[model samples]
Target: MAHYFVGDIQGCFAELQKLLLKVDFNPSKDTLWAVGDLVARGPDSLATLRFFQSLGDTGKVVLGNHDMHLLALHGKLKRNKPSDNLTPLLNAPDIESLISWLRLQPLMRELPEHNVIMTHAGVPPQWSLETLRQESQLVSQALQQADYLDALISKMYSDTAERWEPNAIGINRLRFCINALTRMRYLFVDGHLDFDCKQPPENCTNPQLRPWFDFASPLRESHTLVFGHWAALMGKVNSPKLKALDTGCCWGEYLTLWHLESDQKITQKRLKKS
Candidate 1:
């Protein structure tokens, strides 16, 4: 009954299967926590979604930027460029069901037993676990409402602000929460999100910007924070309490999964270049 936290799968179903086999994943006993980007930029988005969905309650997921983009595209009938590689998924007979299932997934998940919080991008240093939970609830509620879901998704594309303000309201606030939980990477000294820097810490050109977890309290409310999304990190962060699992499987890199109890990493290389 082990728990495995996997990095961004990004539609690489074959690699995901291989990694699961390596871990000896037993859906009946083992729990799989995915860091999102489950579909897009790989060979088989449809198969990837189906396989994860098959896991049912055993598989937990957070929505990544790509995942939300897919939902937005489907919900709004927006023009999708060919490069996204989502057409096959869009054309599937059960596309609506798939999208609905994805929309219902939360942006963050807390494993009480492990004292761990999981999200696509790392949580902002400014937000507490309670704040993360409350904001996630707001987004989840909006996504569940059919009439307003599309509108919310449509508003997701707006530019993000530098920092969070507790007083902020409406769609702007929702977008801020989404951006922080799913798209954030670097941050300015004042704890504002820095959208431009994606390079690893060693190569970062600007001294003022810091990785999101740099300011993390080693443990957030005594819980470990596990996240993906920054493949440039290659599963490395300075804090023992912070775990970065994205190894850029879609970019022909490794797919990493962390065993929760022992903190062992089980990784698999990409089956082929996308």
Candidate 2:
């Protein structure tokens, strides 16, 4: 009945299996909390999607940037990047089912008992817990609505605003929500997203930019935050309340699986080099 939280799998099926074996995970009992990026940039996107989709209630996944991109490119093979390795998945017979399931996945997961919120990237510093939940539901509803899903995914890639405004509406608001929850990493001192800085905090030459968690904000400090977008950090950051899980499994680094209750890490090496 142990809960295992795994980092960006990026379609590393073999490594995922190895990590599950190392942890002795049981589908019928144990729960798997995936920190997103479930598909893309690896050898077996189709197999990975199928496995997770088959998990049903046993597995929970938050949509990562890659997952969203996959949905956006559905029925349009020419738009997908070759490096993403999404062709096999797009060609699968059950591709529609997989895409539908992924669309239904939420952008954030709140673990009430653990007092933690898990997202693909860090939560926005400005959002309160209630606001976060409300925003997530709004976006989730838009994605699940077949009539509005394509339009929402098509406009989600924009990050031009740099900061979120409560008054923002329509595509701008959806883009803001998508960026903060899926692609956020660094932030300006004024709490605006800084998309230019992908380097770790120590490597950043600009004092104006700080890791999202390092910003002096109440939402970040009040509860535990588990995120996985910054592989360059290698799960190292200067915050007791934050846990980074992405170890660059897609970049030929180790796949990390952290046990929430005991803070134990289980790792497996990548089979292919990036």
Candidate 3:
């Protein structure tokens, strides 16, 4: 069985299908790992969510910022934006089931055999593997609980909580966890999260800001870290241990599919509309 890891889909379903076809992906024999942002921006969010939901055990996905935003909208905590292109997904007859499935997906996935770990954005430099697992589970568990889900989703929208505090409790802790796992891109020299910069490393003019992956982490020594979300990275990183998979498919670039064992990259460009 082969393991193929894909970048942020962002509802580009047709392109995803083309990539799968290129790789000759057999769902029965291969497992597909998605770095998240499964819905939004591109067309056909409904179909993309449905296809992943139908994959059952063969598909693995982590939650992205867009996915969390969809949850907030579903809960009436946030308004839908036209740019998100999620109207069809929200209006789908199976929307409840789709959202429920999405909520259960973890913020982090670890493949111990391959010594690989994945999150939507890069893991925080301050967190150890155990801390990462525990913190991720906290949000996932809260999201699965009907009583706490709405309140949790409501409080997850802030960027105020930047630094990680071991003793932090309540909503602040949850917000930090969500931001770090899903929305993080750059960090200040003082080791605080910077949410403002979305440019690629080379183009970033801020001297104080560094891409999150630039910081040294013990986790990188033992395992390869795969992530998506910063589409501007365009599948480039300074270190081999850090894999940036989002190639901006939804932005008219291409989708990337990485074969885990052989380290082969297969890409499919966005199809132009007729």
Candidate 4:
């Protein structure tokens, strides 16, 4: 069975299907993994969510910032914006089941057999893999519990905590973890998360900032880290251990699909307007 890791789908269902067809993907014999942002921005969010939900065990996804935003909208913690392109999904009869399935997905997923770990964003330099796993589980547990889900979603929207604190508790802790796992891109030299910059590393003019993967983390040495949140990256990073898969298919660019074992990259361009 082959493992295919795809970039942020972001409701680009037509492109995703085309990519799968390029690989002749068979769900019965192949596993599909996504770095998240499963819905939003592109057309057909409802169809995209339903398709992934139907994949069941063969498909795996981590939550992205968009996915969390979707949850917050569902829980009435946030209002939906028209630009999100999610109204169809929100009005779907199976919305509850789809959201529930999404909530149950972890923020970080580890594949020990492949010595790989994936999150929506890249790993933080300060976090050991074990700490990352534990913190991610904390958020996942809260999200899975109906009683605490709304409260957790309500507090998840801030960027105030830039650095990690071992003693951080309650909402502060959950917010920090969520930001690090799903929204992180750059870090200040001292290892604090930077929220403002989204430019490619070469174009970044800020001296204090560096891409998260540029930091010296044990995670880089221990496992192949795959992530997809930064579409501006256009699937490029310096290190062999780090893979940036988001190719901005929703932005009229191409979709990227990585064949994990062979390290082969397959891409499909966005469909042209008829």
Candidate 5:
């Protein structure tokens, strides 16, 4: 049973299917790890959500920013962007079941045998592995609670990067956790999140800002991190310790799958966006 980690799908269901077929994946045996964005900015959002949701026992997804947005809107926790196109998921025949299943997915997974940690985006430089584990559970608890709407509200706000003081578990703390898990890409010199920088490291004027995986990164000892948020950085950043899978598939780049064990690369069949 091979484990294949695929890139951001972004509603391209056909491409995903072709890529899985190329690897000869069997639902009963092989495991597929998705670097989220399972729905958004493409034509088949509903179909994509349904397909991944149906994977049930075989699939795993680390929630992306867009995926969190879908969850927020799906649960009525936030307003949708005018450019956001999630009508298909909202109107799907099994939308409720799909959303419930999606809510159960963990924000981070550490495969000890593989020594790779998976999250929708990079882990915060300040967090220790133990802290991440504790907070992930706290976030999961918040997600599973009666006031889940409140939790989702806190989870979607990425602008707040306040430090975790004491046992921080309130709304602001939740926002910090969500941003670290889903929207983080760069860090300010003070190690605070620089959430506004979307440009590559080379172009950014803020010398204070640094990509999440700079080899000497503060969190390097935690685990081999696998993340996918910076489509601007493209695939397989040189931080050899870090593995990025978002091959910009939604932007006409080929979707990619990297086998964790052998480091073999697989590309999905492309259907050019017109």
Candidate 6:
């Protein structure tokens, strides 16, 4: 009867198992919310994906940058950056099926009771929950259709505008998908997406850009939204309403999960550097 939200799992299946055990997670009764990046970088990417896919019932996930990249890269549609440490993943024998299921996952989830909008990077401050859900569905529909991944892979890098007009398509729709599913971090004072900034908010010098949750009213006043893209922000930001769960599990840090109703904390086993 409990709902749990977990941060970026990366490929840390062992840590995920330990954390689930610690929480006494019952698959039949409890729900697990994953903030994506389910595979890549860490060990046992195959195991992690298979384990969750077996959960099969109602494990909700939103695609993160790495997760999307894994799909595109595995499908041979896109090449990762030189800095990406995905050799272990590329070499895994079961990589094909692992990616197929990953690509089938949705890009956003809405919690009815808490009114929590769940996504990997979260909705931009300019977008309301309804607008965000509809747009995400647009992308999801295209993704689920046949030959859509091929289209998405072919036109992955064009449009970058902040506002959406009526029924935009092709690369424009792809841009919405990418922004919602992948590269989101900062929003401009005018509610535009600012993809340039990377430093933590405290160290950030750009006064024009703010986090997505700093918008005017209702969105700010509405129920809390949960997300996990910015590993640098870490977990338990203490915003009272907003919850950030990524604890940098892939980078020798701890994996974190949170309970929606009780505001409780759960931690997975951490890895030690050799």
Q: Which stretches of candidate 5 lie over 4 Å from their true place?
A: 162-167, 215-219
Per-residue error for 166 in candidate 5, Å, reads 4.9
Clashes of 4: 0
- Model 3 off-target regions past 4 Å? none
| lDDT (tens digit, per residue) of candidate 2 on 1-274 | 7888999999998999999998889999988998899999989888888999899989988989888888877945339889898889988999989988898899999778878789999898888998889888888989978665556866676669678889988778888888899999998888899887888888999988878887666777678888898999999978777889999988999899988878888899898655
After superposing candidate 1 on the true structure, give the runs of residues whose Cα lies further than 4 Å from its correct spot: 216-221
Cα lDDT tens digits, model 3, 1-274, are: 9999999999999999999998899999999999999989999789999999999999999999999989988887888998999988898899999988998999999999999999999899888999999999999888888865556987787879999989999888988999999999999998889999999999999999999988888898888999999999899898888889999999999999999988989999999976
Q: In candidate 5, where is summed lDDT lowest over 10 consecutive residues?
A: 160-169
Query: Looking at model 2, which ten-residue stretch has the lowest summed lDDT?
Result: 146-155
lDDT of 1 by residue, 1-274 (tens): 8999999998888998999998789999999999989988888989989988888999999999999989877876467768778899999999988988998899999898879999999887877778889998899889888765556887777656557989988888898989898899988888888887889999998989988887855346588988999999998787688889999988989899999989899999888554
Among residues 3 or more apart in sequence or in different chains, the pairs in candidate 3 whose N, CA or C atoms overlap within 3 Å are none
lDDT of candidates 1 onward, in order: 0.87, 0.86, 0.92, 0.91, 0.77, 0.76
Clashes of each: 0, 0, 0, 0, 0, 0
Regions of model 6 farther than 4 Å from truth:
80-94, 236-238
Candidate 6 TM-score, true structure as reference: 0.90
Worst 10 residues of 4 by lDDT: 146-155
Candidate 4 lDDT by residue in tens digits, 120-161: 998898889899999999999899887755578877778897
Superposed model 4: Cα runs more than 4 Å off: none
Any residue pairs clashing in model 6, and if so which?
none
| Model 2 bad stretches (over 4 Å) | 75-78, 272-274
Candidate that would win on lDDT? 3
**lDDT at 195, model 3:** 91
